[model samples]
Target: MQPVQAPVLGPQVDYRSLVVVLLSPLAFALVFASWTIFAVLGVELKRVLLFGEVQFAVLLAMPMLTGALAALPMALLARRVGGRRVMIGSLLLICPLLWAIAYSDVYLEFLLAGAGLGLGAGSLAAGLVYVASLCPRRHAGLALGLYGAGMLGAGLTYFLLPLVSQAYGWPMAPKLFLLPVLLVALLLWIFAEDAPRMPHAPLDSLAEPDGARSESPSWYWLPPPAVCRLALYYSFFYGAFVALALWLPGYLAAQYALPLKQAALWALAFTLPVGIGQIVGGALADRRDFRDLRWWVSACVMVCLFLLSYPDFTMQIHGVHGDIALRFSMPLGGFTALLAVMGMAMGIGKGSLMCLLYRDHGDDMARSGGLALALGGLFAAVLPLMFVLGNEWIGIRTAGFMFLYAALAVCMLLMLWDGARTRSSPLTRHSSQPPSQAD
Candidate 1:
């Protein structure tokens, strides 16, 4: 008698899952919108708390360090407890913390609130892993890109939060923010599904039925090298962005000798473009038409460096502050152009690496995403320290330290080039495909 063939359950190919996948990032993004509140709020808090410069920087950076350390564990927890559970729980947990920050009287109490927010923000890593596991093989890039827009939520907050805080007061500003969080949390709690289990069937028969585990899937996890490079790249990429996010206003204030509000408004021009660039880069990644991401990313980096190198660019305007006349000159155009290019590079590079990693190592996304957060967090944590050290040693009169940041980006590109050359094997190539209808 001829041997019978086993049946395949086939892949769960659908676009509707994309919407579900996106919610995690969207929720996480909103949480991260509050992540930098400590940094933003610290400006006012420090005045009341009377912290030293180093202490202020510490408060600004510790949340990132805490969040980074928390990511891997959160990923593992999500897998065990269910992604929807952890995600919804995180949103709920953040509500009290945001409200607490508004009312805290003591500095230590406020810092503790910031730390609590960091713990809540760990949802981002879990969300990334959750989204990665949701989509079928083919649309992973586009799916991840849409989800990744959560990172841009910070830019939105930076531009808008101050205005809100000014109008409603800091205490009430977060209350308004929490409204959206509550709404998103409710939706995710009700709608998000747990990861589906592979159906089981009898194993004794030679001819296995459909949905049986007669054969193992061919998917592999992210490799050690790719993980290392990704960490390195994200470390620099996120570090640069974080450093800018924290210090740009201060830099502009000193450079132009502008008042606090004017400096912040000018910095908004620099940071807001980041969101636009990220969206544009995501659109590019979704198409997958841009094969050599390195070339485009490198070009953007070079343009950014060139624009940032020009020290004489001016952005001066007159403003009245309570009947006192003021004149300020900001490097608005130069800084904005540089930030936009960096944002574009970060978006393109991050999405490309994620697409490539998932394509090659779908099974390893949990680990890869964890590692990305770890290193990225470490970089973000250390960046404030770098700014302090750079200013202390060399002064902000030059771009020397900024070049160190640029060099790190260049090194990441080199590593990617090396990986492309050495690791592009036949099996890897074959497996690194988007899902097919037949998969």
Candidate 2:
């Protein structure tokens, strides 16, 4: 059997690469923090607007909708003009909208402001493209993972916004975020540099041999099949992460009957682990094959989701003379622990998926990453509405977990089928290619 070759690390590291890695995540964190401002603020908005469950869900979903819509366009523009331009332009455009959200007195106004704020979320695709351009190929996974760890910004919002709102009112939270947004914008303008351009083949030409030519298809066409599959994978891992980050505060308040502040704290417990786990996941992907890492993580998360899907259950048994009662429910502490475990697994899966994309589509990272993020964000936007509908229609508070569990089960089955097909292929016997390459 042929041994797998180790990834080649470039002989020298670029200091500019270090700068991009350090600042990009920090900038992304600030953008994410602003993008997710609605999660915490929506609680206050619900009270102010006197909105019903569905209405509030829509309110929380508005930014995600806009983010999803903008992701692909922003990514394409970044690829053409430069990531720095896209990132800076996006940050600048959202600042006014955030300020408007702070002062919005009515529901429509807040919705409009939120739609504008959605542009902030598009920064993820731009940041991914930008960081990939700067870093060495061997280190792309770790670099993207570190940048992705900026998701901790959501945790920061969960932890800090409630406290600030308590002191200065919820309106002040958006205003406070403006400071960081502006600061990051200035830093990016001063320090950020566009990476040297790498030559790329058309996505359609990827299957052809070296020096082969194919028709250059229209730029606006649908993504390739591999991109769609990766997007589906991302929709479950990162998309679910986005949905839960926004939904958890409300879910905790409703399900566990906790106050807003306490609910935010509990939600933070889940968000922090997911954010930190990305780094570990990325590092693992750099050293090992991402396919194996993703499969193991997905399997573990499926178990946790299965366990979490059960609503508080109670049973009555009739005995010879008397009645016996049985009750089964996960306590709050235990539920939070399970969520933490799931978050860790998701964090790893997110990193591994990004690594896999870079490895397979290195030439078209911008377009592929952008489309994947757009689909994931679209899924994130839709899940909140589903959560509200599930609760109302089924009368089960844990319905959201049930939905997630079913989706993950389907994803796992597809992975298994793909694995089987690979092993059965004639190429598998003769080629020493990595499992990821075979896929």
Q: Pick the candidate with the highest TM-score.
A: 2
- Which residue pairs in candidate 1 have backbone atoms (N, alpha carbon, C) closer than 3 angstroms, thus clashing? 137-435, 138-435, 221-364
Give the 10-residue window scoring lowest on summed lDDT in candidate 1.
1-10
What lDDT tens digits, residue by residue, belong to model 2 across residues 260-345?
88998898778888877888888888887778777789988989988888899899999999999999977889889999999999
- Give candidate 2's total backbone clashes: 0
lDDT of each candidate versus the true structure: 0.64, 0.81
Model 1, span 1-439: residue lDDT tens: 2222222222355654755666876786787777767555566566667876677777778778888888767865665566677788888888998888888887787778777877865577767767776775556666666666676666556666667777877777667668888999888877777765323321123445666544322222233785676566656655566556666666666667775456666666545544445455545654564446756675676666655645444454555653444443335675665666576676666666566556544565666777777777777777777666656665654363366446666775686786687557765455545344112
Tell me the deviation in Å of residue 167 in model 2: 1.2
Candidate 2 lDDT at 223 equals: 72
Quote model 2's TM-score.
0.91
TM-score of each: 0.77, 0.91
